[model samples]
Every structure is written in structure tokens, then in C-alpha cells.
Target: MPRMTTERTKTTVRIDPSTASGEREALEQWLDFHRVTLAQKCEGLDDTQLRTPSAPPSDLNLLGLVRHMAEVERGWFRRVLAGEDAPWIYSTQEDFDRDIHAADVDTYEEAYATWQGEIARARTLAADRHLDDLGLGEHRTGERFNLRWIYLHMIEEYARHNGHADLIRERIDGATGD
Candidate 1:
């Protein structure tokens, strides 16, 4: 919830892994690539454009995706992986998709910073841990997952969301690539 003076910026191009030799290297590189992809999709958009929903019937928007991903990063990495007492980024007990409705410019800035912070923390927490190391889940099922599984899940999640971001971005400004 701390506001950062410097805002998070996205690279127009995503970095490709050239020497990902091991499981950890490959997973991390791919995940980072997807993260960059999502950021790239949202680059150069204004607040109103970002807040525009994916059509009349759907409520999905670029800024909403940004906020939602912030929550997802916090949930999986900070809360679940590191077992920190971190609260939800934007959601609540009453409304799970609250983050998805955030629309203002301030919310956009904050969400991007929060997502980047969570990504950094996740990287730090996973750096020393092996891929096979386990993290306890706080869900009702009481499940446990390995770092490798989390990496894979995150990659998938970002990939899927990046696809949505692509559609939303194109719809917003008719910009399309990659």
C-alpha cells in the first residue's frame, strides 16, 4: 500500500532466453518474459483507455488486468510461497474481483508498482530455494506446492492474461504486435 515516487516502466520489447540451460533458468526466464509481455501490452496507454472494458458485455480492462495480476502475484508469492502475513492487494472478503474494477490513473500507477514489488520479492524469496522446495498453501484444501510448480503456474497465468491483455490493448488503441 506504500506509494512509490518512481513509477514502474515497461519495455516495449520482451527479453528472450538464449542460454536457459537448467529447469530453474528456463522457468525464471520464461516467467520474466511473460511478465514483460504483459507490461509491454499496457505501455503508452492513458487512464481512460486503460479503463475501457473489453466490450459492453465484459468488464475486463487493461488497468483491471494490471490490478488483478498484482493481487495474483501477492497471493501466490508473498502469501503462499514466502508465508508472509500479507493481505490481498485489492480484493476483500466481500468482493473478490475488486482489483479488476480499479480505473483511475492513481490506481493504475499503484497497481503497476505493487505488481513489480511483488515480482521482486518473489524473485528474492525463490533465489536460494531449490525448485523442489515446498510451500504450504493456505487454502481450504491444505495443499502444498513446489517452487517449480509455482513457477510453471505463474508462467501459465501470465501467458493467459497476456493474451487477454493483447486483445484488450488492441481493442483500446488498435495497436497489435507480438
Candidate 2:
């Protein structure tokens, strides 16, 4: 198969989620807003810069966060919601932290591609499902969750990681914003 090229946007354009939209639309738009926010944080950084740790004690970096989010998207939307038995792209159950700790300059573009692909698949899987529909698989606690809960959790997940991305970006080049 041919490799997919992801043309990095110099500056990301994120639309505000509508205030008057229905529950589903509002949730999706907010989730998308946070998604673009994370991408914006990584904009204009090279692989070396992307792989730079936020601090000596922490291995957190923009690239690692991107890869981690890809895994998150796959786990929640594919493995749980859609019940697709999809294998992980960057880590395994035995060593899930591999996604965050294994960041390398060589895997920069591949990480972005994998992340984007997972996001696309996630959107597809959620499109036809109603907000109240329960996922095909249960959460780690063995409790089933609905699409609504997944969207909210994903939004929270991105929001938290995007905060880290913001700090990492600032540490790299002193750029900062929403």
C-alpha cells in the first residue's frame, strides 16, 4: 500500500462549535474543536522539536501525545464502540506506555498519519450510532457506556492533553494560545 501524505497546515483553522446545535452535533463539534486545537499546538514544529521532552523528568512531547491520542481514538471508538478488534498502532496491552515513551524523529509523520487515520475511523464509527446507543464493548471496569459518554470523555481527554501540548509548544518555541 502507498503511504498517505499528510500535508501539515502552517496554521490550523478551527471552527467554534455551535451553541444552538443539538446534543450530538454539539458534542461532535466540541470534540473536533479540541482536535484542531491539539494540531495547532504542534504546527510549525519539526520532528526534532516535536520529540523534545517537556522536562527532564517527563517524556511528554507533542509527537508522543499525538501518537497517544491515536491509540485512545482506536481503543474507544474502534475496539470498544464499533467492536472492531483492531490492533493497536503504537502500543500493546502489556506496554501501553510505549506510545508515549517511544517517540522518535523517524516516526513523526507516521504518527500523524496514524493519528489522523484513527480519527477518521472514529468519526465514521460514531456517525450512524445514536447518542444513547451503548458501545459493543464495556469499559475497563466492565460497565457499558453510551456514545454520549464516550464523546464527553474524549473531549475531556483531548482538553487535558491539549493543555500539555500547549505547555510543550511554549517550552519549545515560546508560542502560546488557545
Candidate 3:
């Protein structure tokens, strides 16, 4: 699942596809829905509220989730799918989980900007390519993947993270629902 951040204005309500006519359109719509959902989950929260963990003995905060998602978006879209030499925005090789710890307002702002930028680049890259077009995978085996798979994976990622976000948001201030 992707992670989330704190400190966002209320997101515009998602306009779910009424009747997507093709695979690309359907995939894009679903992805966009999940993206908006994540933003909505973090709405009306300050940095401190976002940084509060979901439960004891857990570091899974909303702000950490946002930072983590930024890393995930960059890793998949920019680095792997786009074939760019992009690096992790928050985490490092020595500590891939670094993004999930100790965030502030500035960190939230930077992470949100980076995540949105990556999303824009991913959209642009997808617009120029066919779903069947392949990108080299970043794993040790050097496999390849299609844009379709990436879209599905991102949708799945956001869906899962949004579940966590729901719980965290409810715990934070009694806000809940799809």
C-alpha cells in the first residue's frame, strides 16, 4: 500500500467514471479516484495530528504514510516505469523506512509536492505510451512490465493505504467513511 501525509485542504470530491469505454480510461479513472481518496483522508489535519500513530507500538502515522507514498510513486513511476535515474526522495539504501519516521510541517509540504510531481510525471509518461509498451523492472532479475500492470499495481497500492488512512483518520478525530 502507499503511505499518506498530513496537512491538506479538503480534496475535491472524486468523480468516478460513469462508463469508462476502454481499458486505459478505466484504469486511469480508478487510479485517480484512489489518489483523491488518499488526499481526502488527510484533509483538515495539522502536522502533529498527522504524525500520531494508529496504535501503540506502531509507527504507522498518516504523515509517515504520505512520505512513504512519495517514495513509492517515485520508485515506480519515475525510476522504474519511466526509466529515469531517480533516487528515493525520503528513504535511503541504508534505511528504506526512513520516510516513515519523525515528520514535521515542512516535511509534509515537501513530501506532498514530490508525490504530486511524481504523479504528474507518471500521467504524462502514460499518456505518451501504449499500455502494452514495456518498461524495465528494477528488481535483481531485470524483468520488464507494461504500463497496464503499473496502473493496476498503483490502484491496488492506494486502495490498501487508504484503508489504513481511514483507520488513522477515524482514530485521530472520529472522521470515517468512503
- Highest-TM-score candidate: 2
Tell me the lDDT of candidate 3.
0.79
Q: Give candidate 1's error at residue 70 in angstroms.
A: 1.0
Off by over 4 Å in 1: 1-13, 103-106
Whole-model lDDT, model 2? 0.86
Each prediction's whole-model lDDT (CA): 0.80, 0.86, 0.79
Report the error of model 1 at residue 154, Å. 0.2
In order, what is each prediction's RMSD in angstroms?
3.8, 3.7, 4.0
lDDT of 2 by residue, 1-178 (tens): 2232353557778999998999899999999999999888888876677778899899898888998999999989998898777887878778878888763334667887898999999999999999999999866687888899999999999999999999999999899999
Leading candidate by lDDT = 2
Q: By summed lDDT, which 10 consecutive residues of candidate 3 come out lowest?
A: 1-10
Each candidate's clash count: 0, 0, 4
What TM-score would every model get versus the actual structure?
0.89, 0.91, 0.89
The TM-score measured for candidate 2 stands at 0.91
Model 2 misplaced regions, further than 4 Å: 1-9, 103-105
Q: What digit string (tens of lDDT, one per residue) describes model 1 on residues 25-134?
A: 99999999999888888787766677778888889988888888888888787777777788887888888898887734356677788888988988998888898888
